[model samples]
Structures are given as C-alpha cells and as structure tokens.
Target: MKRYQAVRGGTGDLTKPDVNTRVQDNLYLAVNSKWQKDAVIPADRTEIGVNTAIDMRIEKRMMSDLDKMVSDNKVPAIKNLDKAVTLYKIAKDFAKRNKDGAAPIQADLKKLDALKDFAALNQDANELDEVYGLPFGFEVEADMKNTKVHVLEFAGPGTFLPDTTSYKQEDASKLLAILQKQTVKLLTMAGMSEEKAEKYVAAGLKFDQKLAKVVKSTEEWSDYPATYNPYSLSDFLAKIKSFAMRDFLKELLPALPDKVIVMEPRFLDHFEKLINPDNFDEIKGWMVIKFINGLSSSLSQEFREAGFPFSQALSGQGELIPQERHAYYVANGVFDEVLGIYYGKKYFGEEAKADVTDMIKKMINVYEDRIQNNDWLSENTKKKAIVKLRALVLKIGYPEKEKKIYDLLQVDPAKSLYENEKALSKITTKYAIDKLTKPVDRSVWLMPGNMNNACYDPQRNDITFPAGILQAPFYDLHQSRGQNYGGIGATIAHEISHAFDNNGAKFDEFGNMKNWWTDADFKEFNKRTQAAIDIYDGLSYGPSKLNGKQVVAENIADLGGLTCAIQANKVDKGSMKELFENYARSWAQKQRPEAIKTEIAVDVHAPQPTRVNIPSQCQDEFYETFDVKPSDGMWLDPEKRVRIW
Candidate 1:
C-alpha cells in the first residue's frame, strides 16, 4: 500500500516499488478510467472547459444550500445582516445620548442602505455564476480521484538544470531608477534647492546601493534552516522596546511645521525595526532617509501602535473545549456527531483525536528531516535553521483568548447598515491604539485559528495552520494515508518552505532582520531564482501572462515544498508516481468567473490548472510517471528546467 492512504483499506507491500504501481493500476481499473476521463471532457455546447468540473460542483452545492436556508428559515440575504443593522442603530443611539452631533451617524446609516442593496443583488447564485466565470464540476471530479498517481509522477527522480537568467539585475536597475526619481521629487516638494535635490537623490541612490550590497552578501540566508529554541521572553521584550522607540521617532521627526512629513506609519513600522539602530545618530539618519523616500503621514499612528504586546493573553487561558471535541468539529463539522449519528459528548470523540495527532506529527517530522538533509544550505546556516525549526509553535483550533474590545461597543437591534460599519471601524481603530506602548506579544496569531489557510510569519519565524483547513479532501481520518499526505501534507510543506523564500530570508534565526550570507552565495541564489521566474513567466493563461516578478517568491516556495514533500515520500518508500498525482489533486478546485477575475487581480498563487501544469514541467519525475515524451503537452526542454532549492 502507498505510505499515505486516501481511505482506510488493505495495506500494500511496502518492499516493492511496483506496489504503488499495482495499487494505482487497480484503482484506475476499478473506476473504469476511460469512462471517467470521457465524463470530464465537456460537450461542444458547454462554455467552460472540462477542467472546471469540481469548482462548478462546489459552487452549485453552496448555492443550493443557501437557497434551502433562505426558503426554510427566511434567512437574511446576507450573512450577519441583522447584526450589522443592530450595530448601526446602537451607534446612532450613542451619538444622540452623548449630544456629540448625529450628522456623521446619519451619514453612516446611508452607507448601510447601499451595502444592503449590494447584498440583495448578490443573493442569487446564478447571478454570481454569471459574474464569475465558473469552472465545470466534471473536470475537478475526473482529476481529484487520480491525484495520488499524478503527484508521484510529477516529483520523480531527476537532475535540475541550472538557470542562468539575470532577471534580478534588470529588476534592481528599475527599482533604483524609481527610487532616484522619487527622492528628487520629495526633496523638491520639501522646498530644497535644485542642486540639493539632485544631491539628495544621488545620495539616496548611493545608500540604496549599499543596502543592496548587504542583501547580496547574505545569499546563504535563502537556504532553509532547521528549527531552533524560542527566543527568550526577555530578548523579545528588549527588541520590541527598541523597535517601538525607533518607530515613534520615524513618525515624529518629519512632522515639523516647515518640513514635508512624508513618513507614513505602515512604511515606518515595516522598515524601522528592519534596519539597525544601534546609535541615536544612525537611527535619525535612517528616519531622514525614509522621509525623503515618500512615506505617507496617515500611517504614523498605526506604525507606533502596532508594537503592542498581545502574547501575554496566550498563557493560562484554559482549554475552550476538549481535544476530542475540537478534532471532531475540525473533521466532520459536527459538534458532537459521528457521520450521521448524534453523540452526547460536547465535541469530537476518540476517532477525531487520534487523526489530528497523527497528521500533525507526520507533517512536523517531514519538515524536520527535510531541513536536516537539505544539500544546498551551508553547515553554519543549518545550525540556525535548526533553532528556527525547533522554535516553531503551532496554534490549532480557535484562539485561546479572544480580544475583549468588541464587548465595549454598543449594538442596537434596529439601524441602517452604514452606521454599523462606522461603529465597527471605530472599534477596530480603538483596538489598534490600545496596542501602543505594550511589550512584544509573541502569542498574537495574525490569522484566526478557523481561517482556511496557513502562513509563515518572518517576523516571528513561525508557521501557522488554521483549524478551517484541517478537514476532508485536505485531511481526513477516514481517507487513505496517501490521500491525506498528498493533500494536507503538501500544504504543510508549502508553508514551511515560505520561511526560506526570498523575502522571509531577510530575518535571522532570532527573527531579527539581519544579513548572514556570503556575497558569492547571494549571487548564485539570485541567478537560480530569476531562472525559475522566467520559466513561470513563459506560461500563458488565455490572454493573460503570469507576473513572474510579483509571483517569484511564492513560486519558489511552491517548488520547494513540492520538492521536499516528494523527497520525504521517497524516504518513506512511497511511490513517487502516487505522490506527484496527489500533489496535483491537492490543488484540484473549480472557480466562478468573478472569483477568477478577482484572483488574477490580487492572488499570489497561480490558478488551479496552471498551479499543477507549470510546476510539473520542471519535475523530471512527472514525465517519467506519465510516459511523457518531449512532444507531450506539459513537457519542457531539458535545459530549461530551473532548480533553485
């Protein structure tokens, strides 16, 4: 049997490589592969490609469920509509009580009405389908079933071709030009003499060159490192204290009446702690440089306050629910039910408990082993990697402690939607302000626990997996291990890889922004990355082209994680062919046209099919598993395959 099974069934002999092949062949034969394949190919009359099948089904299912809810319960058109209206009423009442003037509150009421109208328009699922180009469901169904086979094929053994692109050189030049132009403009706006503006721009460019040099000298940082011990609480406190002080001044210095105060809080907060500030003079100089670089004024307060300590709330918070209950809710979406049967227990039972533990353990072990065995990284860097790896703290389920600010705000049962929005905004801003002057709180999770996603925070050097993503199709106890590992395990690898991607590499083991690579190493890293980007850029999706520069960081992580997961499977004696297929299946999803448009505009990840096809091209294993020749649709020239990590 494959090391990872999708559904619990009979185990296969682990001793033979052909065991996976036999399993896949039998599974394909059992399902009548030819018929399944034919079902996915849409008729000429259909608008969407067969590739869109699963997305369409998900959309249809959601729409049907929503319709039933509205009909049976007469639910509001929008989720939480009643709550929004009530908040607006309360804001208005509060305004009246305080005699602080009701004009602003009345204006908010108008916005609510607009929001309600928008919500009403969106209530029709068919309308949503029209707005978002929907992928066909048949396509997804056809692909998802055979994911294990495809993933293994995708990551099979092969040498990676060295990429020789100088794409970063071009990008660096463009960035330099923009900075030069912006610097001059800012100097002129601040009423500097023409000669001084020119000098300032020249000086800024020179400084940028220095900064780039520092970055270039630290290429080894690009390699993934093992986990480390958590930074001491005292160390975290000291760092935040210094960062807060520097951030505050970065905001205050340029606020003088005669000078242009271009320093925005967001930019300042982002860069203030990132740059070293050992001496007061050096710190002031950095602030001046930022002011000349066109920082906005509106972000000052936000930057200063963002340093708030929230981690203190994490400890001593008693468990919200039993472990079994938490696991059951994650897997089956039932509070105390098994399959269809109800249980007297408050949460999940024994079955769920075992599943969650097993999955988490597998993911962590894979990551630890990969970091230890990585060949591209230096031994010194490996030690630091281990520190970061060991320091990783996983937060599952919901936040142990919820922010208490929401309770202070008043809500009325009746009011317009706009008023409620304003009240909510006020509450959020108040919470932001409350964070100022606090100690660095490591426990504050950037994403809520239930969000259907995972992320790696370079600031804290931690990877997070939310509860919302730990369910069926992604991870399920009932599914075979091959399916679960290929699905959720791939995602876990992706997030772990992010810690070593381009931008994340800027931080050191202690999560401080520091350079720790040799110059020669940095050059090789950039050369390799640019090559990867070029390959991705060549990929076409209809009329649009992939933004190689913008997507380079994420693409690197995708490739690395895919690479690591495949390698881990091999170490465990799993079939490489099954792993590749399962990897592809993990990304199997359909999309609405509206959603596709939105994704193209802002999403960092490639669209579903491209996510599978493009990466597969770089993996030699994929071609071998599918018996793909040079003429195959997904084939790339052997020389063109870029291997960065």
Candidate 2:
C-alpha cells in the first residue's frame, strides 16, 4: 500500500513486448505498451515507472531549490531548515571529504576492535547504541497495547540477507561470497591486512549463519501486531545469560521500567550461546564488519567504491547516482520533516488539502456502506469497524509544526560527515530515551510531505497523504474526476483498507491490540483472507513464483480498495472504461530481472502488473468496462474474486 520515493526496479519486461497486445489478454500491456517500449530506464536506475517518474520530478525540483538557497544565501524561515542547509553543505563538500579520507572512521574502528570480551562489550552498551545499532536488536517504541506509552523492544539482530529464508536458497553461497569480498575490501582500507579482513568477514558470516536460524523471517514479521509479548522487568532480565541487560537498560533509559516487550521469545531462548566468552572472537568480527558496513557510505570515496558491490548486486545499476543527488538524499534523510515543510509551504495549496480531505471522507462513506452490507460480519463487528473507519485521523499535506528535536540538532561545521551523522544519532537517541515516560505523540507525521508515498500507521490509527503524491497520475485538480478516482481514489481507499488488513485487524479503533470480532465472524474473515491468498499463490513472476501467504495482507487490501473505488464511481455515473484504463496505466512499469527476483523474494507488495491485472479482473465492473469474455486469457472465475473489507 506504499508508493516508493525512489527509482526502484519494477514489473515490465526489459525487452520490448508486442504493442498490439489485446486489452482482454493483458490490460496493463495494452494501455501502457507503447510508453513502455519508448521509455529508457536511466543508467543508474534499475526500473522506471509512474511512481519513479513522479519521484524523480519531485527530487529534481527539491535539489534545485536547495542549490539555489545555498548559492543565494536565502534559506527560508522554516524551523530547522538552516540546520538542513548546513548538513547539505557538509555532504556536498567533497574537497574536505576527499582530504579527510577514512580518518574520521578510523577512531571508531579502533573502538570496536578494543572490545575483546563480554565485560568490555557489556560496559560499553550505551556507546554501542549511540554508535552502531547494537549487535542484538534493541528498539524503544510505543507499546501496541498501550499506544500512550513507550516500552523497550528486544529481538535478535537481523540477518545479512533480506530474510533468513534467503540463506536457504541454493545461490546463498554465491551471495555470501559477494558480501564477503566487499567487506574484506572495506576492512583493508580501514587499516587491517587483507588476511585479517578476510578472516574477520568469514568469522562474522559464520556467526550470522547461527543467528539466522533463531530469528524470524519476513513472513513471520508481517504479522507485526502480535509481536507484543510483555514480561515483568525482572523476569525479562532473568532470560538473558552473561549479558547485564538490567544495568545496560538503566544506563540508557530514564528509570528501571516495570516491563519490556520481547518480540522473539525463541531468539532469547538461545541468547546465551550467541553471546558468550568462548565465541568472543567470532562476535567481535561480526561487530567490526557491521559497524564499518553501517557507516561506510559517509566515509571516503574509496569506501563507497569498495562498498558498491553488494548494493549494485541488489539493484542492477551500472553506476551510482550523482554525488549531488547522494548529498541531498543523505541530508534530507536527517532533516526530512524540515525540508518537507518547506516543500509543502511553497508547492502545496490549502484548497487542494481541503478537497482531498473531502475525497477521503467520501471514500470512507463507501467503505462504510460495504461493511454495513457485508454478509460475513455481524452487526457487532460492523459497528466496531465503522467506529475505526470514522476515527482514522487524516494527515493530509504536512504537519503545521515540526518535532522538537529538530530545533536541538545542530550541524558542526568542523566535523566530518560521518562524525556529524554520529552526532545527530546521539541527539536522536537521547530524544527517544527522554520520551519513555511521556505520552505518545500522534501529531508527528510518519512520512515527509516531499515523499511520493502514503501509509496507514495502525498503532496511531491514522493515514497520511503527502503533497508529493498529489501529482499527475495519483492526483491533480486538472485531472477529470474519473481519472483521479482510478489513480489516487483507489490509492486512498487502499490505505484506508489497511485498518482492516491482516495485522491491523488485531488493533482497536484507539490503536490498542484487542480482539473486537466475534469468533464466527473472525473465522469467516480468515476464510475470505485465504480466498485473497489463493488468487495470488503459485502465480509465476519473472524468474520466481509468488507466495500467496507472504503477500496476502496487501492483496486483501488491493481487492477491498478497488472494490470500494468501483462502487464510489458508480454513485456519480463516472466512466467505467476511463477508470479501468487509468488504473492499469498508473501501474505501468519496466523492471530488471535481478531487481524483480529480489522483489518477489522479499517485497510485501505484488509486482505492478499483478497489482493492476489481478485486482482488476476480480472486480465485476472491469468485465463490463472492456467487454472481457470467458475466452480471454485474463478472464478469471467469479468465484475466485475476493472483496474483504
């Protein structure tokens, strides 16, 4: 349900397909075939599509504005934008960067190497968090059951590959080899001998193999709301072996918490063997590579070249994006909200926000009708669903004010880029720690206004529609109402539908995880959910097959959103043909094979072709719009269609 804000790999063929393709056979190809044939994917980009096109246009405009602001000494009066400009200057200053090649991270590398045993590592826990994301997973977030307060979240560190399942692939050895080669190159540049670097990377990988066996996979993580398994603070500490988690928690948090959430109980059940005296060397090696790998991008150009292989392997890009573009991305990542506000203030209109807000409400009204008429849900369940829909807080364009931490984050001109990044991380770490006792602040937006994306945060019970996504294909005042309905209208419904999606269904209207469905109604809902899964399971994607269960949440949302969009359009007698064509047109894309393989393996959403074609066929209006016959290749059985809102 998210549109990426980057030039990601996509769904169309790399080679040209027949432009004379019939709409009944493949609607996506028929509507967007010619455009796909002519469009050239940039050398640095793995794929090209409508979302990437919109993202490129927005990023270009923002980069140009940033340059002008810096050159003319005319930064806007927006809060903390001056800090962004300062960081932007730091990122763009390659002369200083080239001069200070690798020196900035050398000290940090020494610090990591200094940890020889459990005592030293345990003693340096706070610094470990401030510098590197710790070897074991640690996060402070608002508890799912109690959204008003924060809790300490613990889990095993993530595996090197996309998921633990990837480690089981036959080509796993080859992929691990590529990562090893790059890590060795990076460590050697960090003043280690080639032999030592290779040994360290190999040892690190061995540890990774062990860790992967204990951690959760992407599919398991998809059911995220069920991650809340709280234990009393003392009982939680008793589970760990040889790690002074109690003392570590005390050093970082405001006070000793009453409870902590353990995300993966199985991971902790094996925590003793993972981090002990006998395995110190292997653990240290893993730590060395992880720290250097995390901060290598902001290091010297040598480090960037050394580190490019793993990234290039994931995305089949010929070369990196230009340095200026990289600089903007890095700086913007740090000051996202500050620059988002600037973009929205200059480019977004108040009238458009009001109009889109009205559009969202109307779409919700249609969804409400569907819920009321739903056969599976009883009246009790429908009432709760309606309350949740009505309570969905809308973050239309951007927030009126920024988070307080931005005012406190200052860029030190004398420090290196890596050092400045570390400094910012420290400030943010302190900020999050300070919020442990404070009430959760839902006013802080999840995505920046300059991002070409939208999301539904189940924990906060809200949906965000950024100004950047309000462009040609998704939304615009000039587009006809029918076109908009096909584009952003379906998209709006898509995000709203997430409130009732697989994971979100566990949470109540106030964003607490509680069962609100009757036993039989929930059983019926699961049956429909399986129907959505059956629609996509075992389907062939390029060089891969789709996993129905892995993608069922998004597929369910897609069907529900498209269904709601179709019903809403019929109310106004909108052109069904126009809606269907634009819906396919919006998902038009061309993807590289390497990118497609990775996407199918890890990405939650189906390929763009699947998104457009599969969901469209399920809707009855689609058959009427294009005169789809039973003999057509794309014609699907009515019994296979699923609409679970």
Candidate 3:
C-alpha cells in the first residue's frame, strides 16, 4: 500500500492480468458465475417456476375452451359474414316498409349480392391462409354493406325509446317531411317545373330512406355503450391529468417547441423588437415567429422548384405538406404566386375569374364572423382576432405570379435518378441561403391553390380552403344547402376550432405568442378539458389501446367542430339530426392494421372508431336523434360529460 503506483500507464505485478486480459477474464468470470447461479437454483423453485406454470396452465385452459367453441360451430370463420347477412336482412325489411320508389333498395340488393360473392370466396380459402393471410377480408367485405346501412338509418323515421318521453318520435318524421317540402319550394324558387320538383323530391326521399337503412345496419355492429360506465370515472380523471401534465410540461420546458427550428438571427432580431416585452414571458416567443417565417419560405421554395403543374400540386394530387407551416403561408399572402399562375388567361379562362373572386369574399366573411363571435375570447383578444381575419389577403384559384427558384438547379430529363436528387439538394441549399438576407415576404403560397384540404394558421390567425376541396363531397352548387353545409360547413368549423386547440390557444389574434386568458378562465378551461380526457382514456378499440393524453387536443377540436356545425345548421333552419349524422358519415372509413399502427404513433387525430363514438357521446343532439338511452351501449354519465365552447 505504501508503494507508489502509476494508475494511467504503469503495469502492476506479473501475477495480475493486463487491461485487455482482465476484461476477457471478467467476461469469462461473468459467464461462469451465471452458470453457477443457475445451477444452485432448484428446477422446482416455487416463486418463479410456479407462477410460470400457472400462467401456462391458464393459457392452455383458454385455448381448449376456444377450440371447443370453434369446433361446435358449423361456420367457425363466419362471424362478420353472419353480421353482414343480418344487416342485409334489416335493410330488405326497411326497404319493404318505405317502398315509395324501389331504385335505391335495388341498389342495396346489388351490394348484398357482391358481399355474398366475397364471402363465398373467403370460405374457399384454406384455414392456415385464412387465419394469417385473410384476417381483414371479412371486415373489408362487411364494411361495404355496413356503410350502406349507416346512410339508410340517417334518412328514415329514425329511432324511438319505447318507454321514455323526451321529444316526440313523430317530430323526426315531421321534420323529414318538412325538409322535403322546403327543398321542393327552394328548387321551384330557383326555377324548376312543378313536375320536375316533384320528381326531384321523390328521388331525394328515396335516397335519404336508403341512406338511413345503411346507417342503422352499420350501427348494429358497433360497440356503443347503452350507459356510461361509472367504474370508468377514476380511469378518465387519471387520463386527463396524465395528458394535460405531459403537454403542459412540453410547452413549458422548451418555451419555443415547434416541428422545425429556423436559426435566422436577422428575423429573430426584428421579431424581438416588434413584440411588446410585457406580452411575451420569454425571448423564445420571438424565436418561434422567426422560425415559422423561415419554414414558410422554405416550403414555398420547394413547391416552386418542383415544376409540377399548379393545379396538380395544390388541388388534385392530395400531397401532404407540413401542416403547421402550410397554415402560416395560407394566412399570409405567400400563396399568391401560385394562384396567379392558375387564375391567369392560360387557365380556366376569364369567365370563371369573377366567380372565384366572389367565393373568396364569402369565405373571408365567414372567417371574420367566426373570429369576432367566439365567446370564450376576451374583447382585447377579439380585436386582435378581427385584425388578423381582415389581414388575410385572399389568393383565389392560382398564384398571380411565379418564382424562379428552380432556375438555380438544372434538371436533365435524361439524367439518372441519383443525379437529379443531387441537383435538387443543391437547389434547396441555394434557396435557403437566398432567404437568409431577404425580408419576410408574405405573398408566398406554401401549398398550391388547387389542393384538396383546408387549414387554420395560429400565427396569422387565418383560414384557407384550397380549390381542390371546393368540389364534390365538400361543395356542390347543384346540391341543397343542407348537404353543402354538412360537407363544407363541417370542414370550415373544423379549421376554426383549431384556433382554440391546445397549441393554437397560445397564439393571439395578431398571431403573436401570448396568453390571453384570465387565470380563472384558464383554470375553468383546463377543468372542462380534463373531463374530456378522462372520458376518452377509458375507451378500448380491438387489440390496441387508445393514447388518451396524445389525442386530447384533436378530440377537443372534433367535439367543438361538431357542436359548431350543428349550431350553424340550426341557425340556417336545417335539420340538426341530419347535420350530426352527416358529420359521423364523413369519418366512415377503413384502414390496414399497419397503417393504423403508424397513425397511432404519429397522427394527432384519434383512430376512426374513437373519432366517431367518443364525440357522439358528448352531444345531446346525437343522443336525442338516435334515441340513445342511459342503458344504451354509448351512454355517458351526466356529471362526467364535458362541454367546452
């Protein structure tokens, strides 16, 4: 111990192993030690061995039970098929009862025939292949029939409670009749013949009736609750706290959390001076605005360089852009360049230009009204909201100009794919460098005008509906206002609700990062939001579980959008039940398991089943429309249900 030793490089006694030798020796010792440890343990050890044995025995018992059930059944793989048959039978009966005209029913019959063919094909597949290869085949075939049933249920007499007195069951029928009459009146007012109006009404009635039958059939297979589970309350509260805590922590820690970070010092400097010091708690607020500006510029450059036709990129192609950044560009005038290209003399000709301008003006009016009338917002915030709404410069159809960013990079059609990629990289880098010194340009479009989606920008506090989404299923001049509102109106409501969602709530009407809520008001808002979190957390879907905390913001938007759309329809004297049903129908979809798994991890929106079922539980209109009872599968406890507007 008294002897001096050099720890870094000097060797010790010859009896000891060297560093590398010692490492090898230690590894060997570890292997031998593990073996000895295992050898010392008895095979019959009660603690670990008994538990595993018990688990295996229980699993065996369950498997045996399942095997018995499968063997006893004549059609072991036919549960979905049986459900489809039952739905088809219900549709046939409904058709018979409402046989004013048979065209729609005949169409349903054709669908049933197709289902039968698919089922037969499934039956012929081997058990091994069926189990592993075709698990989704049955569901895919059944969904076709289910969708039809869903549509039918919306149009018919609807449902009634056998014992309770709420609204008259006949009121729904009376409403439908009135709707038919008014539709005819409106058509006649728009200049259709009496005979043509009658024919149109007949066709419309038939379509609604069939649609209701389809809806009912689909609903039959759904796992909606008859009543809210009291046991779920504890779980719901826990979930709300977890989600809120996580998001709150995320927001507080970074102070400037966003998808992309742009480190442009000049813009950051300008932003810092522009924002009032009292408004921002930290310097990070300025960082966010500058980053967003850079992001918008980057996206605009990318779109411009792609050299794709304007309509193909913006409207028809359905290309997904980074949503957060795209929202910012749409709010600013940055989208004008692309719009000019498509709306000019070369595209759509000049006749449609005036119509396009009128549509844009109407859209702006709707945005302005929404911003001004939001009750939860304070007056100071409302003025800012109004300013932002007014400042949203409209860019209809296509941009009025184009950028030459792509000219920096030459693309040869004959070049190899790798060569083209290198050229693109160079172009992107050059474009980014070019933006470093330029003043922020608001007249750029992040997405093409022809795109089929819409968005709300928290920074700019503006909303945009691209030209692509302006077509069928969203907007159709030939369709009734009820249909158009249910389709496009719901979409508008969805975008507007985003303005108040968790992240969006941080931005003021002027697109500045700030808290505009009073302490009391913020507390109240959190309490209500927590209630929703708890409700959604208890939900189960198939084999996977829902991440309640992750989906709270989007869920809030969904519920709010539905509520807003229903209110809007009521103001227009439209059927509230129809509006609710249509909202549900818009979300009717199917997906592969792999795709669903990916969505769960990355997508902010909840899974399809939860999207449809959870929001419906919050709406009194839905409960009344569908005759849902406290004992029904989809009921929510009165005290536990959350409503925030």
Error of 1 at 551 (Å): 1.0
lDDT of each: 0.42, 0.83, 0.40
lDDT assessment of candidate 2: 0.83
- Best-fitting candidate, scored by lDDT: 2
Per-candidate TM-scores read 0.51, 0.96, 0.44
Instruction: Find the 10 residues in a row with the least total lDDT in model 1.
Output: 151-160
**Residue-wise lDDT of candidate 1 within 364-439, one digit each (tens)?**
6666676677667676666666666666666554444544443454444453323433345455444543443333
Model 2 residue 416 lDDT? 94
Q: Write candidate 3's Cα lDDT for 511-552 as tens digits.
A: 555677666656767777777677666454433345565577
Query: Which whole-number lDDT from 0 to 100 does residue 321 have in model 3?
Result: 36
Better of 1 and 3 by TM-score: 1
RMSD list, candidates in order: 19.1, 4.2, 34.1
- Candidate 2 per-residue C-alpha lDDT over 290-400 given as tens digits, one digit per residue, 9 for 90 to 100: 887887789767677778888777767778777888889988999999999999988899888887888898999999999999988999999999999999999988889
Candidate 1 yields a Cα-based lDDT of 0.42
Candidate 2 residues lying further than 4 Å off, grouped into runs, are 1-16
TM-score of the candidate numbered 2?
A: 0.96
The better-scoring model by lDDT among 2 and 3 is 2
